[model samples]
Target: MNIPKWILDVFYSYLTSELIYFDGEYPIATPVATFFNPTKNSIILSTSVSFYNKVKCIKQNPNVSILYSKHEYSGLSEKPVVLVHGSAKVHEKDFEKNNAYLSKLIEEQKETWKKEVYIKMGRELDSFIGRRLMDWYMLRILIEIIPDGIVCWKKEANILGSVDDLSKTIGSVKGDAVFAFMGEKYPIGIPVKLRKSNRKFLIENPTLNLKEGQKACLLIHSHNKYVKEITLTRYKGRISRISKTSRISRISTREGEIGEIEFIPTSKFSFKQGGILNSIRFILDGKRRAKKFLERYKKT
Candidate 1:
């Protein structure tokens, strides 16, 4: 792989177990759901990876094709991480059964993931999503194809798209998104309310093709516009109002203290509105912003 091992590790470290599938069909997902959260909320793309097709794709359609265009021949393709680029299958009749089986799969995960937590004075998991993932799970899916290839990117390299606007790790996202790409600038998604039974959140006329099985990148934006977030490439969405917590546990069991352990959190934020949004992309420009990010990493 052209990218460094540590850089690869950093990229993988940011991957939250959730899979972000891509497709162009309209959604056949469960209705929208509302989740509660108690924390302030808070995401890039580049081109040194691949210049031609990305520009081509962006110019071709500007939305669906552009996203696919970047993936057509990315610099990340030179890396070692396995890239499973293909389609997934959804078995509606099997959804309930799959959910039941997944419960067992989760129970099995407990053996490996089980860990004690010492919530800060007034913190509880329920305050987030409670125990059950109410909005999703019932929608059944089964990937029928395998990944076409493997890929990666150098976190420290300035080869891909504009590095300036991409956020490192400080974004929170809620709602659905419609994507579009411009020139060499990274592809952008316009956040919209996840559609559900309730019709409350007001969104303008949204564009872009999305479906239940297709994949999309979720960029969680921080309340502070300055700090962006690492991208979460997962299926368009798993559940609504998803709680993505930084589980850096400072355990104080019967023992005095056990220090801190960081655990990747889940997120599926919700909103009472839906539709298009008129908004600015984010952050610095290409060359200068990339220089700024390179400096920040140097200090660390």
Candidate 2:
């Protein structure tokens, strides 16, 4: 197996440096370098001649551990370390490859140091020292963790009162689900439907297809003891008032007989009404009319 040249260089440089570890309770040092083998998917250690006896003792026991120190700027309380409770064996091929990588890595380090010296020379004396004194080295590690499932905070509220599922409906109306303090006598069971005339006039037009499973207020008009719903849909814009003027003539009829009913929009029932119920009813009607307009547009 072959590893990238750049990665091999990094591995070699890290290996040659003395690795500090904890032996029992006291800190111990190991003057060994590591080399990686692609086939084994592990790193191999090369012990120095001076530490050869110490390495032999640890190899015999085969229950040693390795600890890596954290950079001062790591901002972590625990030092990065790994433990090994297994035996070790010498691999000649791995050792040879490690040695070659380490030699090249050391050369690269020398080049980097030379460049640093040039950079420092270009800066002010005080600035150069400040840069070297700064203690901030960032270290990042990547790990993957997958969640099993989600746990909702309010199970009952989510199933019954959650507005997430009705986002489309609320968004279509340009409104969000919110709780309002309506009077105790607020009618909650009334079934309101969208109407077509609502959209012809430039009112808040919510589409009928996006009906929300919630109660809305409506304006109920009573005339001649008969309910005739006149929402933002039925008489939109100034058209209703304008239509009233187009009458040919008004003829008087006998008493107790209906002559003619003049239809006109007054300020009392117009969209400008400052009542929450009226506004809700107007919006609902506009939504219905808007839906009809869309359907007609689709057919044409």
Candidate 3:
């Protein structure tokens, strides 16, 4: 569904006062000069020409996510909080007023930003804007986020903060997934909402010292304080891609490994062919063996 402009307007309002966190190969939490271009239907990230690792990583794998709040959870007041999942595309080139879609957005973005400038910069506001525009024409990189999904809340922040308010909070499903690769383990938090839909999980660079073409096993144990411990085992696959601090590279899309890795959260079943059935069968077979072993030995 096309996002209504009002939602875009709300997101745009936070761009100046609140900051957003960019998570991909690395996690960056910094105040950004950002604008939402209605034409491109995306949020634009502009920075100096010197390529940040993020730029290279986006090119390697476009999957990216961002988080933001009116306050950095610093206060208990309800305010706009958003989580954005999107694809990031990097652009590097000499800037022109009409060089690309970005060039057009820059001119329009400036108009809206100018009013707030005087309020922030005082007497040097004009000079500041001029310098900023000139810098835009210099060598630079742009990261445009085409949002896939968004979660926003304005009044739930305080409720989410308390441990005792365990109504919806306690009811929310969450899990800890551990992935073993390269002789180390990665503990990832899986929200209840994403357990069924999340197929690809990202392990940040240097986290487990992961590299391209490496093999790994993912163990999803979705049992938190609110729910029973359900350990889903044997989600295995080779490293498909890795986002280094410098750049990202693809490892594989479809591999020949059967029962190597699997993601079947519902009913222990998947409809896709090509060894998909074997993994489910394996899981069921493993469960039967474990149940028999428990009944014969540990049941007493």
Best by TM-score: 3
lDDT by residue (tens digit), candidate 1, 225-300: 1111223222233222211221222223222221211112132433221222211121112234445544654686
Rank all candidate structures by their TM-score, best first, as comma-separated numbers.
3, 1, 2
lDDT of each: 0.25, 0.27, 0.40
Clash total of candidate 1: 45
Give the per-residue lDDT of model 2 (tens digit) for 137-207: 00101111111111111111111122232222221111111111111211111112222243321113211
Worst 10 residues of 1 by lDDT: 34-43
| Model 2's TM-score against the true structure | 0.23
Best by lDDT: 3
The TM-score that candidate 1 achieves is 0.26
lDDT of 3 by residue, 1-300 (tens): 376543555555443321222233222223344567777678776654332544555566665544443332122233444445566777654344323554455446533333243233323423665454333223356777787655444434222211221122211221233333322111111121112226665542212233466554444332222122223343445566543331112333222211112222211212221265654564455455444543544444
Clashes of each: 45, 6, 1
| lDDT at 208, model 2 | 20
Which residues of candidate 3, in runs, are more than 4 Å off?
4-6, 17-26, 71-78, 97-115, 118-138, 156-300
All candidates' TM-scores?
A: 0.26, 0.23, 0.40
